[model samples]
Target chain A: MLNEKIICAGFGGQGVMLMGQLISYAGMLEGKEVSWLPSYGPEMRGGTANCSVMVSERPIGSPVISDDATTAIIMNLPSLDKFEVDVATGGNIIINSSLIERKTKRDDLKAYYVPANDIAVELGNARVANMIMLGAYLELTKVVSVESVMTALKKIFGESKAHLMKINEDALAKGSESIKAQ
Target chain B: MAKVLMKGNEAIGAAAIKAGCRYFFGYPITPQNELPEYMSREMPKVGGVFLQAESEIAAINMVYGAAGAGARVMTSSSSPGIALKQEGITYIAGAELPCVIVNIVRGGPGLGGIQPSQSDYNQVTRGGGNGDYKLLVYAPANLQEMVDLMQEAFDAADFYRNPVMMVGDGMIGQMMEPIEFKDSVSRFDLPEKDWATTGTKGQRKPNIINSLALDPAELEKHNHKLQKKYDAMKENEVRYETYNMENAEVVIVAYGTTSRIVRNAINDLKEQSINVGLIRPITLWPFPEKAFDEVPAACKSLLSVEMSMGQMVDDIKIASNGRWPVSFYGRVGGMIPTPEAVMGKVKELIGGEK
Candidate 1:
């Protein structure tokens, strides 16, 4: 793909912004042009928080993604409710089945559901749910390689948090594997 | 130089340091808070001064003092905060002091939402402060350009001995993108600050840096000198870019983030067999009037896209000089116009051209 516009959205504490940043950083690692823009407002934690991530062979134009999202990774019920229609025709939608009880009603695009929070809890860190969703998105799209994401994580966390790399890698593997089995 | 991903605000802060700017004074505001935060941490490490002033008024005066002392200085604020600094900016300009001011603009008529907006176009381009002064304004469209222009802003300030404004909106301040810093340091041959107020040291006559002149004739002379410099800047510093204008039927004029959206619109219009082009002004003050002269002869109409209520369209019309019909499309109050909307507007303007 020459370009991909993805919206990662959930409640504030779900690491929606971090997931977007990871995707952007991974795109940078692969020597592609990337942009990550987080929605900023008066909302605090547990409120609706989302970020727009764009990876392209050419430089990104607008960081604000009102619509025309090539992929939508929604982690909660509200996010799925909000952004399901924004997905472009024939685009892909990934839903976190652990928190979202409803399914996307659109028939034009592919939909994949992962119990991301449950999978992260299984990996002993529920905070990594966004990482799980990121892995699933990567597996489905192959926009950036998993190896690039790993390198990006190392750069992000650095030496002080090096010990947590294993669990993140495991979470990524489990998420990608679950999608493959489906 | 290695490319690293950085937020636009943080990259500008780092670029200022790279350009040898060691004195930063500013009051904090939303959407641009990261700039001051980055300067707070980085300035002290470089033996530089970073003061969080009591207010934007006090901050700009501090810049005046530092710049008068021959120090490369900078101050940044958002919309309302920048409004408070206008008086001081006018004073600095009158004194012919070199300083860099950054305005990461947010929506405004008053304390508008902290989201990005290009509504400050008129305020910055036409002197926001009182008097007949001009600030060399640069509007960068992306992170790399932001970094490059932040460095160039300091050079331009010193080269002209005037305040240079780097105008960007909230999206440019908040978005993260990869940027590569220039390998070589800036090499502009700036005039020596022999007239700087550095206590005189009893070796020569004491230098006085004041904008106040009791005699109107003297003030007029000073204003005329400033006007001459501004004319020279208009001739030498106008910057812009043209995209796909070779055989375009409609031309879109925009700058900063709005230009990016226009580029996307151009791409989509091309796919539909609509030959559209873009003229992106990089310098708001110099305004790039010459770019309109280069608009293809095949172009039938001109369209200006902005995040403001068509502030730049007037300039586009003036530049095009009625050679073609001019149209404008804009969204204000922190709302960003989408590519589809811009393309729709372009199609409307160039009816049946496809």
Candidate 2:
């Protein structure tokens, strides 16, 4: 853990919360202190959803508030509208360009708009857009290694989803490669 | 040696595992649902038992059952749900069964708002259930203490042969905090037991954990024994924190989250040249009256701030012994008073007319 707090947000069913959990789980796998907190209650249904994942080398005091977020992942316009202001100065924002039309306007912050949905679709799974976005985050933020993320994916999906793991991995590679291009 | 950032609920769940607790029974309630949800997934991995009971009542009873088995058993709930567990809690105490209960308190007189509140201080410290029984209540202020106290609660429960409670408000449960687990302080060396109802095949006799002493004499003796435990707890376990009180004129007494808020109030009071300090009770039941006794002669009054309508204020008054005038300020339900709001009261007491 390196005191990195990422707030992942998007509309419901976009796997916004799942993306956050994966990052948290990955941090945990790396023996880092990590917390994942999802927005609560009925708002989880058809409303905008957000989850906060904080990874630190030290013990975290509060998972919810961070003026030091090193990275943020926004899947849609609603997410960008909601959390773009809170991204720390100099933090990176990984945006899904397919949905969020307006760009982040911060001079101090770095923004990369990846067509995550398009890439996920090209990989034959729109649901994996969250993974692609996470891949973009991992690449741009260098929060975790691709190998570590693959290990986490294996643990999370387990032996049963072994087949779908390849496509997800491919999508993640594409996202990473795109970030390298940028 | 490694640290993991985790929700307060998740931290407690993980701590329970580290503490050698193998049985968990609980019902889901706001601000604390993550505890059970995390246990549901993690318990199986550790070969532990996690059951989502039908309600708070049943959850506590399941705790009773597992505790009687002489295994480390635990349960958790929010305010209203904890209220429902009161009856079973009393029974657990009366039976002297060792177990740990966690109250991730939310604001409530009824189905209060899901936001965190320290309103449950009195109920937890004074025995949330009925009877003369007492719980070794450990009130943790942050996530690190949350994990540490969970382990303490289990050890204390077994040590005293009574139920112990870990009391924390919504903030401690929901806040993300950095915490570390040390192997030295993490594991337990609890006594080996033949009291568990594992199997009767080669057992000397069946062990039954029951509070129903049909004979009046036996019941009275049992009650007396429990009283001795409570008395001993009062003497040995009262926990508190005193801040900037060497020459303080006003003593602000608070507990749990309210105490943290009062710390801010004290800072603001100091900036105005008001000599004020704080005495925060970390263990609400064994209310740390000892610290209050050390209040400087210049202290003319004590203030009690809570999230409930002065529930803890009543205790402060009793502890003060009418020495200094005790005052009360509070916010009810799920509404937490801002530090500014508490400062207003502090100013009125310390700066304005007493």
Candidate 3:
């Protein structure tokens, strides 16, 4: 019964594509149908980049996420402004409060503002900010397991970048705890 | 290898290597740029050669040269680059060389936007090349299909000794999906290259490859030869898939990413008890014309959905042959049509019940 249509958006350096890929890879490992499509072309370098991800028990259709998403993971101010409207009514939006600095404008959505950058700074790795936001998302939805995400992380990092996994795992836990504590 | 996540561009390279392709010549273009990057990185590891030609024209001519020497060679580019390669593409076809050409299409009648689009339908299927030539064109909707068809493309090219074009929009090049590279069956009994220009050991006739037939009747004979190969391909290599077609009132025809969006609409329409079926053409050149015959007699309308302003609709119309009233819905210039939008079209076609 786990069918989630999600959009993850942020500044290009904020690792939103990685966030989308991790979910798709984890869902694939769990034998769920998954697809990740990014906003490509001229804006990939410094512009706001976003990716749509679908993980479902049934076959996925149309990787483009225009509206009615089950979740929208927002990592920056512009991302929230753009994607907040895409979330389905009564769906969840995990906002990166450290950078976004505002609330979800939609009252129907259940918003969880995780201080992802601040949490990453505390966790001693700035790049894991996206993982913190992802962690907060997993805690709320539980669509895919944290362990599966870790396995997917290991695969993505491969042997060369294996050293970074520990910090990312810790960031995920802290981000998850932020939601669980509330 | 276990299934892993890969972008469409990278997976295409992987499949080519699996298919025993040894030479890749390409010029960089957005969306498909990653494919040449993958080939440059992976081709050498397999002891194959990868070249980034100075331009698309040079790249495709390089393909013609390598393919003439009996190597499974390929070249890739986006819309404008593919347009640049047209002259060389026609030469390869005229010379009857077997090679693979990939067009990861972007929007254009000119230098259009860089987004997902199917605007190059006419460009690839109709072909921009000169003379009587038809390249075997394949339009894969997803990454998995891209890989499978990419491998098959090589076999089909070598089988018929004709050029094969593998096409996908920008979305098919950029999207990430988990794909497994299975040992797909080759459709043709791949014959030996008795025609290749490999240097004879002074033991056989030295092969000379040229597209020129100066005499009018000689050129006509050559055209008939190429046309015969195309006719054989049309007879044997048409591929398509049908979904939810039983007793449906509206049958939508589409290909590639547009077909994926249409599937979503069909699923949603089922909940409202308004049945819609899909005929997804996997091969664009052959156009899967016979698929129209499968439409239920109860069908009220035939719809052609595309990411362009109605290019393939003509093919559908020709295929259906006035069996039912044909309609079209499209969004061009890199704009993609959503499922909600497609469903709205279906409602307009068959309103309020069944």
Q: In terms of lDDT, which candidate is strongest?
A: 1
Task: After superposing candidate 2 on the true structure, give the runs of residues whose Cα lies further than 4 Å from its correct spot.
Answer: A1-39, A49-182, B185-206, B264-275, B352-354
DockQ of candidate 2, scored on C-alphas against the true complex (2 decimals): 0.13
Deviation in angstroms for B209 in model 3? 1.0
Candidate 3 structure quality by residue, lDDT tens digits, B1-354: 679899999999999999999999999899798999999999999999999989899999999999999999999999988999999988999998999998888988787878878888888888798888998999988889888887789988998888999998899999999999998787678889998999999989989889999999999889888888889989999999999999888999999999999998999999988889999999998889888888999899999999898888889989999889999999998888989888888889887545
Model 1 vs. true fold: TM: 0.98
User: Across residues A1-182, which tens digit of lDDT does each residue of candidate 1 receive?
Assistant: 56899999999999888889889999998889899998888897699999999999987877778768999999999999899999999999999999999889999989999999999998889999988998899899999999999998999899999999998888888889878978
- Rank by TM-score (best first): 3, 1, 2
Model 1, B1-354: lDDT tens per residue? 878989999998999999999999999898899999999999999999999999999999999999999999999999999999999999999999999999999998899889889999999999889888999999999989888877778988998899999998999999999989986666578788897898867899989999898899998999999999999899988888999897898999989999998898899888998889899999999899998887887687898898888898888888888899888899999889999899888878777545
- lDDT per residue (tens digit) for residues B248-307 in model 2: 887888777667667766776778777787898888878888888778877867888887
Position A129, candidate 2: lDDT: 91
TM-score of chain A of 1: 0.97
- Give the distance in Å from residue B47's predicted Cα in candidate 2 to where it truly belongs: 2.2
Please give, for residues A1-182, the per-residue lDDT of candidate 3 as tens digits. Answer: 88899999999998999999999999999999999998886775668999999999988778887878999999888888888989889899998889877788899988888999998998888889999989999999988999999999998899999999999999889989999976
Provide per-model DockQ scores: 0.87, 0.13, 0.88
lDDT of 1 at B195: 76
Q: Which docking category, incorrect, acceptable, medium or high, applies to candidate 1?
A: high
Screening candidate 3 with a backbone cut-off below 3 angstroms (N, C-alpha, C), the clashing residue pairs are: none
Give the per-residue Cα lDDT of candidate 2 at B70: 89
